[model samples]
Target: MANVAISELDKNCGKVVAEIVKLERKIFPKHESLASFFENELKKKNSGLLYLHVDGELAGYVMYSWPSSLYASITKLAVKEQWRRQGHGEVLLKAAIEKCRTRKVSCIMLHVDPLRTPALNLYKKHGFQVDCLVESYYSSDRNAYRMYLDFDSS
Candidate 1:
């Protein structure tokens, strides 16, 4: 079995942050990427990042924030293309949810592209329900689903 581990990323860890930024640029479109603002996002007291490493290499990451005491938001979730479909995304997602649980949030929410079937399935498997369709959420031509996982129902 491969050596795998997940841990909270420290905002001051420049090397890891740089690596994540590089991966973000590769995985997401320019307008959707938070690569340029990652460091600043990490500096926020209510936000944090958790990363998964496979054989000591970065495999995936999830970014989450509890801006309000009542709820949390999963801002991003990404797995390296090489690591896709190997359960890395699920592991990272579960970790992020657990982190939000620790913060005593009632629910966790996220926005996802409706066309990304794998991602939609993954979130649905974890009990995220689509609350509404967000028209042009990503762009003029793209729509998104606003999904939420309520701890109270779980």
Candidate 2:
């Protein structure tokens, strides 16, 4: 397994953005707004894009936004097919969680497709709990589990 390096993306990240767009097409074929969405995120102070490079190659990325003081939302996360089980996703997720923690957010939340067992398992193993099921959350044909991790234990 190659060593993975995580980096915060910026406007000058054309090559990384291109790679992300390519992977987005493969991972979420129906989502055509990713390029623009990521670009906009690069310009937002409250939003972030983090990419993981394995052996100098783009392996995966995670995007998130701090919508409010109370919680941060994970907007998207994906690891290339070849890098799926090599701990890249967990690294990216942990990075995102740390980013949120720095902002003093009380909780971190994300929506995952119910059909994606591996992703669901990853989040669960990382201490996330399913908050509820949202029908047609992703689209009219897909449902989602709204999962959250609370930093404040009561």
Candidate closest to the true structure, highest TM-score = 1
Model 1 over residues 1-154: C-alpha lDDT tens digits?
9999998998467988998999999999999999989898999999999998999999989999999999999999999999999999999999999999999999999999999999999999999999999999999999999999999999
Q: List model 2 lDDT by residue over 1-154, tens digit each.
A: 5676899997788988989988887888565347656566667789998999999999999999998999999988999999898789999999999998899999999999889999999999989999999998877888999999999961
Residue pairs in candidate 2 whose N, alpha carbon or C atoms collide under 3 angstroms: none
User: What is the C-alpha RMSD, rounded to one decimal, of candidate 2?
Assistant: 1.6
Model 2: runs farther than 4 Å from truth? none
Q: Model 2 misses residue 39 by how many Å?
A: 0.9
Q: State each model's C-alpha RMSD to the native.
A: 0.7, 1.6
- True-vs-predicted CA distance for residue 128, candidate 2, Å: 0.7
Q: How far does residue 70 in candidate 1 sit from its true spot (Å)?
A: 1.3
